[model samples]
Target: MKKILLAVLVLLTFIGTSCDKVDDLLTFYINQEETITIESTFPIGVVTPLSPIPVKTNSSETFKNNKTRAELVKDVSLNKLTLTIADPADENFDFLRSIEIYLSNDKGEETRIAYLDEVPKGVKAIELKSTNAKLDKYIKGETYTVKTRAAIAKPITRDVAIKAAMRFKVTADPI
Candidate 1:
């Protein structure tokens, strides 16, 4: 009878240990949802979103620049577009994964100005929720229109948006 009791005790212990191990494994499989947040800065003398600036896009309604549906602004010096991104809800995001900036020229051509590794003259790019970068090259007084959007590598349906804060600093410069 004692031997049988010992065997039952061992079996109960084994079941308890097995259950604990399974619980741990289940906890490991659970994952938390991730998110990202990007912020921009509009300086004291900067132009702001008085209204919804229309985004120019192609025939498919994808964000692009061309004659029709082209995003535009007055000609401002390169010194005026100071901005930054900060306070990402998730720090694990690939911040530098894919980003692009475009400059519109006199001929109404869209010029690719900057990307992940590059920031245009007077433009600054930094990571953090509340950081600031200045575009000293864009003179304050000049007027310029710009189009900016973030590029996501995953799929076209994904909404990857960034605020293109353009502030034409008031200065005595010509466009």
Candidate 2:
């Protein structure tokens, strides 16, 4: 009985690892980068929601390059999202106590994709935690909207521009 159990466990392990390898072969990444600005006169000590910014997706081109179409896509999720202060040469995220970034489609379907709580000070760039939400439709679409809600830590005298970089992991079936 012991030998039988050990053999079964070993077989299951091999099958699990093999499945992962197959998935890896079908996986690819698509990166999207955009710049957003926080106005200098923006108020402090409030959780404010920013206006939704529309973004055109490059998924069609990326899909073609990967030899896959939107219909063949099996799953899409955010791999990573990073925020960096782009303007003012020497500025950081010190003014932002926390921030949540949302993605919405044309039909108004929305989901939280990434966020950073208790943002570190004196740093030029920070990576936000992914909500692990499935993003297939949003990425497959031609355009989507990005909205942000942030807890401001301090007042800003000048507009602070931030570059938001997002990488998405996509798995699809071969055509």
Candidate 3:
């Protein structure tokens, strides 16, 4: 009887230890890096006020359900965000005085994720990197909208097309 009891305790201990190791492995696998890119066009010939420039992402319609944004992006972190101007390079590009980027959720709440003011002359790209920015607040399956407000140094009579692209580096646990 003593041997049997000892064997049972040992088995329980082994199982507990194995379970903890498995949990750790799962966590390591879930925390991974993903890149999301969005592209759009904005007319910047004139001094345009902060406008809602709709940007599309990889959100899938099939993934939409009753799941909340927090549930979808639980334990996720946004590592970096980059904005690039594809067109109007060098002399062709106008001087951008200020720019602001915002993310809108399903409930229509807009959250500012990035901002740049007094941008350097001839700069075509801007990058925002922070460890504290949590992008999980935006829904996964829903088509979250990205709004942008840009100010140019001068105004023109004709519309000058300014192409913009956004890239997001996110690390999150697998759902």
- The numbered model that scores best in TM-score is 2
Report lDDT (CA) for all predictions. 0.32, 0.91, 0.50
Q: What ranking emerges by lDDT with the best candidate at the front?
A: 2, 3, 1
- What's the number of clashes in each of the models? 25, 0, 0
Kindly list the per-residue Cα lDDT of model 3 for residues 11-96, writing each as its tens digit.
Answer: 99999999767544433111212222222333544434444545444433322321222344443334455555554333333456
lDDT of 1 at 63: 12
TM-score of each: 0.29, 0.92, 0.53
Worst 10 residues of 2 by lDDT: 43-52
TM-score quality measure for candidate 2: 0.92
Q: What is the alpha-carbon lDDT of model 2 when measured against the actual structure?
A: 0.91
**Order of all candidates by TM-score, from best down to worst?**
2, 3, 1
Candidate 3 stretches greater than 4 Å from native: 1-50, 60-72, 75-78, 89-94, 128-132, 156-158
lDDT score for residue 64 of model 2: 91
